[model samples]
Target: MQCMNWKLSDIASVLAVEVVGNPEALIQRVITDSRIASTGDLFVALVGERANGHDFIASVIEQGAVALLLTQAPKQPVSVPYLLVEDPVTAMQQLAAAWRLKHQLNPVVLITGSNGKTSVKEMVRAGLSARDGTGVLATQGNLNNHLGVPMTLLSLRDEHASAVIEVGANHVNEIAQLGPLAAPSVAVITSIGRAHVGEFGSLDNIKRGKGEIWQALPATGGVAIVPVVEADSEFDGWSFWQDALAKHHVIAFGDMANLNVNRGWQAWVGVVERQATTEGQLVRLATSDWGEATLELPIAGAHQANNCAAVVAVLLASGLSWQSIQTGLSEAKLPGGRLRLLTPLPDLLIIDDTYNANASSMKAAIGVLMEQSAKTHAFVMGPMGELGDESQALHEQVVDFACEAGVNAFLASGSLSRSLVQRFDVQRPLADLAVASEDAQRLAEALWQVYQQKGSMAVLVKGSRSARMERVVEALVKLASQSAN
Candidate 1:
């Protein structure tokens, strides 16, 4: 298959920027980092907090960049083609939108919500790849935001048969802005929770903000793969998707007990049956259109079942057979730092779910920890940021669940750690439970003492992105390696 080539003139026309060099220079890719800039590439000079892209223009040119996207003109005359705009980030976004509008890729699936967006995107990409093997372009890393979304769309090439775009937002209307640029044919709403309540102000606002992606669907032949939510549940007072469900084709998944198949909403449904397996997640999914199928998922967790079900719904909606969908889902692999296991010592197992956290995610991680068949279990907690007014209450709820769930230790860090320690002590005193310390070294040392005295143990380290709770995990790994020697 041939690569996509965007001429300098065409890109400049789309970006509405001032060109400084050859207009006919061919471009195959748009890059932001100078370290990876190469031939036939358009290097976008983004002015970030730490570094300015213009400072590295000479290096990118040396790496054979065909064009430069910049916010200001170069200090000296340059031979390479360049487009000067008021803001390079905005210019790149505009170009990415124009590129998607021009190419019109098929089966463009958009996944959005508070949590599980990345995992669901990976599953859908794997499922779509099973369709033919031409190629499926998907969002890489955490590029579901405004800048990241555009970068993913710009990466679309000729060989790619389909695209799975992950659209993310912390504030209101962010998805509405990125959705149109993605131009998705199929839309999936993972779940609506208080993931970024601080930015949204309320759980109600988060529901409305995430629901914006449904607006980008095509008039006809559009498909929606959503969770099974009733008026009392996920769809409380949200009538937009209700109308879309009635008009467009639909595939819904969740607890099978909550749905009424006899009510004539025969949209295909994916359900994770009562798992009877010992180790892996046994997913028994039953869909009306595609019939029933059973498969063992690679990862095991209560939340994972819902994500995999959503993946199956997307694949079935894309017209893939049950066999192909199952094949793709079985081979799916999500990003690291989420329920990933790392054994720094022979007796210590780390449950790394440090990607990001909310009340829902925290509880889910705790559930994963409880499922482990280890001699001891400890939780290295961190603050849940951007929770707005409900931060303390929601965090207290997480603490309540951890204590009620029979956890042996709960060591918290961050600004909220002291008060949480008070709360933890009130619920389960230090005499009855393990100690909670403020110092990182003391925290790690205490946890190590408990594990060494109790035999094999599992530690769940998690927090919001800003909290950097991974430091605790790093410290533990270091101590374990040092002590083992």
Candidate 2:
């Protein structure tokens, strides 16, 4: 994407700054890191938790940055054009909003939640692109944090009619900072769960933080696509929908309810019942939007149905016809390592959900294994992190859930996971489970042997980001490749 030419005056008004130096200095790009500063780029010096961007001003200038946006006036100002704002972080957000308006592109959709945000974003993108000459831009990987949000906005191009940006935060105010940067024409909150429960302290704080997406919606008129999760219901009275109604105007896609999974992973949904299935229920879904189609999704577990529901709502809100939405969803593919199915060896089915795991996601993975009627299901679950003080209890609870779900064989990794081994012995009459050290490499070698011997069993591998569960997935893939040849 070619960078647009920007002037000091264009950015200064949005930032409410008094341009100091040459106002005519042309900025062709905006950058935050001094290392990437290039000729004609505007270096935005933001204050972060670890370091202040203002400290890198000299280096940014040395690298050919034409302008700077800083919170405080530099002790020794340089000849380069710069804008002094009270808070560079806020200034960056305002500037992004202004830049978005200046481009006159299609509407932007912002997605946020503790879980399933990325998947829903992709679903919406697919649904929208199936119709019109839609160009979809989304948050790459997990760059959903404060710094990541603005960087995603800066990556937008003229061809993009709309963007699906994911917003994530562990503390208060993080989402607030990201809200305006994307300036979504429609905002979607997937669901509020126990993510970052340590920092947020209670579920209440998580709800409040997620609510920031609603507060960020532009008043000129916008749609808020909120899943009818229990926590989200609390804010229903104060949502943007009410504000839109007061103007004697309503968005065409407002308040989509009901979703039913039809013949395959396909679903039929109405706006009202859409929020009802936010928890868990596997039902045949048909929708007026996507007429008479059935979809059995490639991904496992019933929770995915809920995630799909959110995607459906976002697509409908974006004005996609039922046929296009159904086609896009039917063609949707899962991300690598996110419940990716490796080649089957003999009767063995390997499920690699090792990308990341939390309690809720873990349960979903286990559920998939339990549903395989004819196969003995084995689970290799590594430690799920960020549970804070509830880590032990939560890990133990997983062991209990696994037993109840009828998981035939269980392997626990990590120091915290060892607790599962201990609980399994006491909870079950026979201690059939194995405990691997926190080292994933060693666990991978051992799991391969188990797979070779237990030829007919289905195996599931899962863990948190820090656990490196991909090592196990790689081992399985290698074994499958060798067997095929």
Candidate 3:
């Protein structure tokens, strides 16, 4: 964080709050948690579900916070300056919005979509940072909400040439409200899928919510990066993205032939040539300005090819060379809990994609598992949450894929996992039995026994965040380690 040195009067004026402290006092830092407050920090006392920051006013003041941003004035006498507003959170957003504009941070990228938002964000950060003497600021660890966005903006310092902010929304008007705050120079919609369909009601609504990022771009000089889709894709067809973003420059990425580069639109045309010796894929990317190159991504799944293509588009929009993009992507690391490969035992390969799950991601992970040459392939899956009415059918559909994908054995856990087990019929098809357990630990034990009897197999572990499916990975790793010792 660069030295903000914002005056008390400036903060109060931006928030329209009543300032009671020395007006000339400069605040070098903005903090929400009292525990992190220092001498020159402005601590925001927000009201949350578990605890109210208002209760810790005295504690923050003692910790050397020069000023306080509060929704309500404290009951006791306070020595430091305090700005009382109707909502501390909104005030923080306003301050961040003002700060971003004042600094005029160039080439800010705002990324949103149903899936691959984090991966794209990390890729952009990696791609940009790999450039000579480049400093980037991004949302830390999936902090993509209203509060998280503002905190990210506040972290923007003078040295930061670019900022990659991930904006996530489950309902209507959420992303719409966030767009104005960030005011990104470039907006990216990774892909519109059935994620959070329960909250948005349908794919159309999801597209509408995600499109808000494009709407948030500046009137004259903004750019939009979107996935190239088929002519009759479900979400892209109704999105009318070209019409919605008619004013801004649009860059699309996907299949080389399918991408619509006509009518002055730019494209990152690419294809996954083949899977590499590593558990990764080789992609050939070609843009108008930056010529073609075969990039090796140390990540699994064909879906990643498109995700990396989107990153390529973002980088090209930022004026990066093909070589730079390749270097950054090659060095980019996929975060844990998302297609992360682990080897606990000599013959056992664990794909720990347990971060979150939905129908599309589930199928993608399963595809990666089946792509492997392991003699036996197994899946430890949990219920995909927030799928609404289609949750049961989606769960069943995944199991059908498992059965047809040549999965040797599998275990289903969580409330919806029972759907897969109930749908499984050994009499009709596969010789192996599908285990149905209520939780990860139980499934781990059963899976361990299967591995004991079967020997040498690849395991794919995945589920939604609510399922905490990473626990299954932990359990299996522990069992393997004990046996190894």
Candidate 4:
């Protein structure tokens, strides 16, 4: 938050609100939570299920907020200007959209998809920051929603050369509506899978919802980075084909041979070839924008192949040299719980892909688990959520996938876990379990007991956000640490 380049009048105009106090007051910062309210901050009162920002009005005034933007002004006025709007949340979003355009956070990359949104966002941020040799504004944590997008934009300062905003949606039209607030120069969809099929209704609906990002791009001079698919029929079939006729540039990634783009558009293609390495893999990417180069993808996992390719396309589109892309990605730190490797004992390797889960991601984790050399390989997970009517079948597919991948043991917890155990192709886990979360000692003891049965073992743990699976990993690691001591 470099001092906001805004005044009460400017915000009022953008938000279609009327100022109730000094219109000339300048805003140095904008905050929703009154707890963080301080001098020069424009505190916008928003309504949430748990609490209402309006409740904190007096507290914000006491803390010296320069102004207030709320649907209703407080009964007692204080030492601050106030902008009364129909809705302060909408007002804040209006300000964010306007601010992003004014600041010129060039090439604001908006990433959305079923999986790999965070990893790709991190990679793009690291790649761009490395390429530019400066700090870049990227989404912090998993704040990638309606409120999160606006908040992310408002955090941008003059120093940032670029911004990577992760846009997420549980249902249709969520990403579509976030476009103006994001003011993205580029938009990329990582992949569409069954992660949130419940809210989206079906895969085709998911395609339409995710494809809305492209529509959010500026009609002219915008860029759409999409994974190459066998067919674009699902993206509103004829409508998506007509999109190829639109003015924006399309950069297709993945197996380019499978995607056809001969529709009189300036289409750019990026291809990825991967060779496995111990820590990660060497990605050989060739793109129409920057020609050809091979870089070591810092993250591990065979499933990361398409993600690496998509990042390369983005980096290439941003005009980054291969050197910066390689170096920056090497230094890039992904947010926790995505294929994180842990060695509690010499023979026991733990793969934590617990960031979030869907059928595709779980299958991918199983692929990674199979690559490990341990005699005993266990996959521990909770039931995947938001899978809609197909949840039961999808859960069974996990068991089938593990079997096909030749996994040695399966350990899971959730209502569906027991049923999953019934379909396993390999031996069941050595120990019974209860959910351990936030590093509960009992959970660690249960997980550790399984590794006790194997001379050398590798375990993969994953679950959806609802599963709180990282706690399982933490508990096991803590128990391992205590055992080592």
Candidate 5:
């Protein structure tokens, strides 16, 4: 694909910025980091929580950046062209919108939810790319937030046959802002759960935030793929979603047979059957729209069934044949740091799901680890962040389920780990539990000892982003390597 170019003067007019040096300079790329800037790239100076991009203006200019997008006038004289605006971040979003409008992309899919957003986005990309002559682009990694969404949109080139963008927000009105910028042809809400309950205050508020994606759809027409929520779910009375999205086509995918059918509503009822395999598991998905098909998913977790189903719904709505959808699902792979299995030793297995966590994901990871037939099953976890007042209670519930599942040990770390360790009095009879002293390597050593004792062991490591539970996965691999040597 050829690089997308925007004239400095055109970008300034779009962003309402004043051009300083060469207004005619052509910007072929947009980059935020000075370390990654190339010739003809427009360096956007973003003020972030930890670092300020303005601090590296000279560095990026020296590295051949043709122009700069700045929030303020440069402190030092620079030979490169530049544009000054009120806010570089907002300017970046406006610039991306201008580019998206210029390209007029079709079948752009915007996905958001408390969980499964990334997985569903990746799955959709896989399904789209499986079609002959289709070029697909997606948000790289967890770049689903405000700034990241703009970058993803701006990265879209003319060659893309489809684009799958992940829209993420923790608080109210956040998705509302991103939705218009994306203006997706299809909007997908994978599921609403307690991912950031602390920020939103309640699940109802989260539903309001997630529903903003559908609200962003053009009044002309669009498609919305949402899960058929159960009666006991926190989002039971989300019928308002239909009213808000009345102008659009809405499709529902889930296990429920009695899905609330609203005006212009189409539903794909499906059920998942899981069977254990030595590598991962086999999932048989029987859906009303596409009929029955079994897939060998290399990743472990029952939640994957829902994620795949959401992908299938979107692909089918996009008018792809069921044969292509099946081929795509068979080739789907979860991004790293999710429920990925690692066999560092012949007798040891690690279910590394350290990408991020919450109440729902924690239980799902434990379920996958329990699928193992190892003599000892252990869970290494950290605190689920953004849970505010209920953090302690949620931690307690996690341990309770871990014990009820008959795991041999619950190896935990983080600020909330103490909650599980303190409950050992009642848990000791059911299983062993301990909290690490904030040292991941030390925790890995203790877990390694537990695994060594049992002839075969399977360990599930998971936590929120702040907890960096992936460190434990790394530590275990390092220790296993040292022992082998």
Candidate 6:
């Protein structure tokens, strides 16, 4: 959309491919799928483990794709412009680099970690916008994997001053491929947690995957910002944290370091102690640059403070003034379905955080429920996925936290969560604990019945993506709407 039209030769030179077709062929757009190919668009046929893009070449060209970048020769020769490369994925990365240089855009910031990447990206976008009113582009959702990263960069426009790309990986070497394409001027590792530890095998592998963000930093003096972790935490092995400190610069925040939550507001004021290479921590008083002088966030959670802290670090690192940061923070809202508060009913408040769930996020949501002044707190929880061997243990841990947090009514859905509820009953007698059958609909209906009988209550709905917790949210909202009618 930013008036991108590069010569075939230019792209060929960047990708180091032999241009065998029309040298003057103009490519205004880049696409991976044949169904979505448009006129004058360059279709990059990447070969995946399951299917090869070369198989779709003829179909894509038939759909008005002007050119193709292929890893292998086409079986049937179509008189279309083409570039033959050893690897189309690598070639796409090369094209992304060339496009960035050609547009002269602001430095890209690459963000990755086991948790909080999306939140950090949003914060960076907000902070950067406050500083310069520059056109900013960020990943739409959790589109931070290998295919998602290139697609995000390809969506960039010449008018955009900067881009914040979120990278997620479940295995090793994933971030290594994404780093060069993003070409981050600054890299931020949000935190290392057991997000996909099952796929990676161990915590060390998880650290190795997250550390790729730092490894991708350009040797030309790039900065890395890492949050301060406990001395005993495994995150100390973060190469990005050490590498930036050794060569360029590193900024650290968090851990009871003169931080305060702005009362009745979303904004915060704190003195961030600048940790010099030699000096440990030195105080620099700073106020958030974005949002109301005092504001409240739409989403409720204690971990939000940590998420906000990471955002604060990104804004400060980006050179935004304190006032701008405050303004931006005030303006920021939670991404949809991440602790989204539905309208208050006469007797209940609905919390729809069903987008996804994990150990840390579950604790944060429960903490928010604990702080609310409700006669009773009800939770409709589903299983958390991808924890590998720790799935059952993690579920039990959440149940223990819930019992300790004083949730009055706990409705566990999903077989795994039901198993956790049973374990909790054996370990600690929870008076109001109910385990629903496999049907999420039946669970929602039962919860609605209880809410109708009770005069006042609060509800939290949460689960992994596969659990479709949003459906439960919809059912509850529908019940409330019908009652009003």
Off by over 4 Å in 3: 132-134, 260-264, 426-428
In the range 337-371, model 5's lDDT, one tens digit per residue, is 97777887888888889999988778878888888
Rank the models by TM-score, top first.
3, 5, 1, 4, 6, 2
Question: Relative to the true structure, how large is the alpha-carbon lDDT of every model?
Answer: 0.80, 0.69, 0.82, 0.77, 0.80, 0.71
Per-residue lDDT tens digits for candidate 6, residues 1-485, read 55467778778888766788888888888888778987888999977798888898888888888888887778888779898888777777777766665555555788887767776788678777875565888888877776678778877776788888998888888887787778777777777777777888877888777777776776756766665565556655444345434554555545444234211212233433332211111223345443222223323455555666666766666667667776766566658777677764866788888888887678778887676666768878887888899888888888889888888677777767667767666655645546555676677677777776665778898888888888888887887788888
The window of 10 residues in a row where model 5 has the poorest summed lDDT is 255-264
Which candidate leads the pack in TM-score? 3
lDDT of 3 by residue, 123-201 (tens): 8988988773467888888789989999989887788888889999988889888878888999999888888898888
TM, every model: 0.92, 0.80, 0.95, 0.92, 0.94, 0.86
Residue 9, candidate 4: alpha-carbon lDDT: 93
**Residue 44 shift from truth in candidate 2, angstroms:** 2.9
Could you tell me how far off, in angstroms, the CA of residue 31 lies in candidate 4 after the best superposition? Answer: 1.3
Q: Best-fitting candidate, measured by lDDT?
A: 3
Candidate 3 weakest lDDT stretch, 10 residues: 424-433
In angstroms, the error of model 6 at 173 is 2.8
RMSD (CA, angstroms), candidate 5: 2.2
Better of 1 and 3 by TM-score: 3
Better of 2 and 6 by lDDT: 6
Candidate 6 lDDT score relative to the true structure:
0.71
Q: Candidate 3 at residue 108, lDDT?
A: 90
Give the winner by TM-score: 2 or 5.
5
